[model samples]
Structure formats: C-alpha cells, structure tokens
Target: MHPELYLSYSSAFAIGLLGSTHCLGMCGGISASLSMALPVGRGFRFRQTLLLLAFNFGRIGSYSLIAAGVALLSTQAAGQWAWAGLLLMTLAGVLLIFMGLSMGQWWQGIRYIERAGAPVWRTLSPLTKRFLPVNNAGQALALGSLWGWLPCGLVYSTLGWAALQPTVPSAALTMFFFGLGTLPSMLATGYAAQWIRSIKSHQGVRKISGILLILFGLWTLPIQALLNL
Candidate 1:
C-alpha cells in the first residue's frame, strides 16, 4: 500500500473535520455522562479533560487495530489486482456511499454491518460499567476503550481504507494516521459539540461530504491506473 496515496492527509482531514458533527451526536451524551461521573469540585474540569483524552485514546486504539486487521486481510489480494483490487475498491466505494448516507442520518440500514462486530462490542461493553464512578484517568480510559466499539461510519471508512492496503503494517499505519487526523475536531467537539452540531445542522455539510465520498470513489480508478494496471 502506498501510504502517501492510500491514506492521504486531505481525505483524513476532511473526514476529521466533517466528523465533528458525528462526535457531537454520537459521543456527546457519553462524554457528558462521563463528566457527570466526576467528583463535584472546581477542579473537575481537569478530571473531565483527562477522561476525554482517555476516551479518545481508546477510540483511536480501536481504529488502529481494526485498520491493521483489515489491511492484513487484504494482503491476500496482493498481485491479484485484476480481480481482488477491483472487488475491494468497488466494495469500498459502495460502503463509502452508504457510510456517507448514514453519517447524514439519511440511511439507517447500512449500520447492520455493525452487527458483524457486535460480539466484540458486547465483550468490551462491560468494561464501561466498571467506570461507574469514573473518578480517575484509568477508569476513564477503560470506559473510552469500551465505548470505542460503538458503531460509527467514520471508523468504518478508516477500516475500508485499511482493507485496501496491500499489507498489514501499511493498513494499520494508514488508519493510525487517519485516526490522528480526526483528533482535533473530535476533541473540540467533545467540548463544544452541541453548538457545533447546531450550527452545522442548517448547513449542507452532510450533503457535501456525501458528494466528496462519491468523488473519492471515482478517484480510486485513477489511483489504480497509477498503480500500473
């Protein structure tokens, strides 16, 4: 996999920036709930920040793991581009479209894919309970990791790109970077997500993101051409 091409910063940044909206909707309640778990005190802000970081660390870790796994699996297709690459790219593109729709909350059925990982989510979900008090960073991190399994289109996109990787390391690295790409906005959303989501609501950002994903799908063909058929 060409990291330079497969996990370009532009795409990651776009996903990250647009993904802020999702952060507001998906993680807003969870983060707020974690905040409530904090002990009451003026210094609670510090505790909240730590909790936020832990949550993001867990989420990013999960994204990286999934990305790597998908990429590793795709390695089986190396040198078989005529069939495998075509199929991978096609599925990726289709997934991207569905994800885009799902992100906008315009389509719900696509989330059925989340069921594929449900058993794993079930295993991790229990860890969140241990953080009932969430009085410290460790528990926050655990809860975050547990929450990382939450269904998400952006995460799916990262995994989709990973599945396009020619090797496991490349796939993982690509997604790590992609996860890194999403950090700023998501972090900010954790803080000011309600306002951000409200502002974004009236805009056409979702529609534009969907179109951009369509363009990304089209971009795959030219990329394959550059890969020398």
Candidate 2:
C-alpha cells in the first residue's frame, strides 16, 4: 500500500477503536439480548461465543457493503468531475470532526445525521425483528447484519471517511479494519457490559480518544499538499 493509503487504513482502525466506547452504549443492549436468544445447553458457552462472533462479523460485512456502495458512487463522481474527490474528502473530514466531538460529549451535531437516517432504519429495523429468538448462528448473523444500519454516527462517519479513498477496494478495506477495531469493545459488551460501560463513562478516556480523532480529521484536510511534499 502507498504510505498515505496505509495511514488512511490505520486512521480508520483508530477511529473504530476510539469511537467504540460509544458503540458499547449504543449496541451493547442488542448484543446482550442476543445472548438471551441462545438456547441453554451444556454447550451454551461455546454456542454463545460462536453466535456473538457471527453477529459481529455479519455487522462488519454490512459495513463493508455500505462502504463499497459509497466508494463506488464517490469514485464515479470523481471520474466525472476532478473536484469531486476534494469535495468528498473535505466533507469526510468535517464529519469526522463532528464524530469526535460527539464521542467526547462536547457536541451533538452528528445526532442530526443520525436522525436523518431514521427513515431508513425504520424500514430496516423490522427486518431484524424477523430473526428474533435466534436459534442458530445463521439467524444471529442475519440479525446483526441488519442491525448494522442502526443509524450510528460513528459508523456513518467512518463510511464517509472510507468513501474518500481513491478506490473501492481501499474503502472496503478501511471499513473492514474499522469493524475489526470495534470487535473487542462490542464483544465485551455481551459478556462484560459493566466494564465496557465504565470505560465509556471515563471522561479522560473520551477526551483523549476525541482529540486523536479530531487530529485524524485535520490530517485529511491537506492530503494533496502532503502528497506533493
């Protein structure tokens, strides 16, 4: 990978990691609920773990699909107009800054974006219900995949950043790694909800993560200048 592209992927990963504290609060309940959907047995522990992994991987797959579509559209737009890429990148930077602020509880600007997605979620939310009382890993996975579209600022912001990548594959890969970065916290939410919540509630942790994300957003602003230098 080019150094800059590598940095982009790394930034995506970092955003997922840092922003995951919010994810715990947002998606944690659903994850824990899935655990209840699992059947009781001597193999319950193994089954629960498998289902959780399936659910999360499915969610990640959903993120990849969204990123792919965004990237395709952005790439096509840029092809038609050279300035489109610059415009998209700048928009992505602004979104990231908003996400960082939201994560830090310093602003609620991203909530508007979240609300804007409500109509889509209303459509998708019903699909998730169909898989409820998940009896198998497949059902859990499907439910999780559907849950990925749950109007999250962090997820949308990350997708926006991924869309700014020059290629579809790069954008897809960015979302993939970002999903991986979120796995730990999200997984913990199912088994260790209180611990994850404690981490999310810590002001110092949020502040530091927010600052890092804000800097990452700032870094994207001068991509062309940096490339030339």
Candidate 3:
C-alpha cells in the first residue's frame, strides 16, 4: 500500500481506539447482553466468544458497507469535479475535530450530527427486535448488523474520513480496521464490564485521546497539499 493509504488506515484505527469510550456508552450494553444471554455450561466461555465475535463481525461488516457506499458516491463526484475531493477531505478533517471535542467532553457539537442520523436509525431500529434474546451466533450477527446503524457521532465522523479514501474498497478496508481497533474494548465489555466502565469514565484518558485525535484531524487536512501547489 502507498504510505498515504497506510496513514489513512492507521489513523482510522487510532480514531476507533481513542473514541471507543464513547462507543461503550452507545453499544456496550448490547455487546454485554449478548454474553449475558448465553447459557452457562462447560463450553460457556467458548460459546460466548463465538457469539461476541459474530456480533462484532456483523457490526464491522456494516461499517465497511457504509464506507463503500459513501466512497462510491464521493469518488464519482470527485471524478466530475476536482474540487469535490478537496471539499470532502476538508469535511472529514472538520468532523474529526468535532469528534475529538465530543470525546473529550469539551464540546458536543457532534451530537447534532448524530441527531441528523436519528431518522435513519428510527427506520432501522425496529428491525433489531427480531434478533433479540439471541439464541444463536446467526442471531447475534444479525442483531449486530442492525445495531451498527445506531446513531452515533463517532461512527459518522469516521465514515466521513473513510469516504475521503480514493476508492470504495480502500474506504471499506479503512473502516474494517477501525472496527478492529474497537474490538478490544467491545470484547472486554462482555467479560469485564465494570473494569471497562471505569476506564471509559477516566477523564484524563479521554483528554489525552481527544488531543491525539485533534492532532490526527489536523494532519488529515489538505493544507500541505494546497501549499505545495
């Protein structure tokens, strides 16, 4: 992969990692419930792991699908209008900065963006009930896929970044890595909810993560590219 592409993927993953505290508040309950719903037995741990994996797999799959769809439209627009690409990148950087602010609890401008997605979530939320009280990995996966559409500023901000990628597949892969970065916290939430919660509640951790994200967002801006020209 090109160095720039590598940076994009790495930054996506870092966003996921740093912003996961917010994710815990949004999706952690459902993730933990998946484990709680399972029956205890000799292979309980194995089964729980399987279901969690399946659920997260589906969730990440949806993230990638969304990224691809967005990138498809973005790349096409950029093809017709050179300025569109620059505009999209600028939007991505701005969204990331907003996300950092939200993550740090310094500001919540991103909540408005999340609210903008509420309509889409309302349309999809009812479908999640069908997979509730999940009995099998398939149900868990299906439920997770729907849950991925839940209105969250962090996800939306990252989608903007992903859409800035040059191609649909690369955008999708960028999101996939982002999902992977969150796996540790998501998985831990199932096994150690209290511990994860404490970490999520740590203000210092949030501030540090937010600062790093803000730096990443600044780096993502196209100012250097424009300056070179």
Candidate 2, 153-220: lDDT as tens digits: 88988988898888999999999999988999888887777787788889999988888778877876
Ranking, TM-score, top scorer first: 3, 2, 1
- Candidate 1, residues 1-229: lDDT per residue as tens digits? 3446554545655665665555556666676666666677898777778888887787777777777767766776656555776667666666666766766667865678766777887777776777776777787777776777777766776577667766677666666666666667556655665665665575477677666665665665435554665
Candidate 3, 1-229: lDDT as tens digits:
8998998888889899998898899999999998898888999999999889999989999999999999999999999998888888888888888989988889999998899889989999999989888888999999889988888888888898998888999999999989988888999999888899999999999999888878877877899777776
Stretches > 4 Å off in candidate 1: 1-9, 39-42, 79-82, 221-229
Superposed Cα RMSD, model 2: 2.5
Best by lDDT: 3
By TM-score, who's the top model here?
A: 3
Model 3, position 100, has a per-residue lDDT of 90
What is each predicted model's overall lDDT from 0 to 1? 0.67, 0.86, 0.89
TM-score of every candidate: 0.81, 0.93, 0.96
Give per-candidate clash totals.
0, 0, 0
C-alpha RMSD values across all candidates: 3.4, 2.5, 1.5
Alpha carbon lDDT at 224, candidate 2 = 78
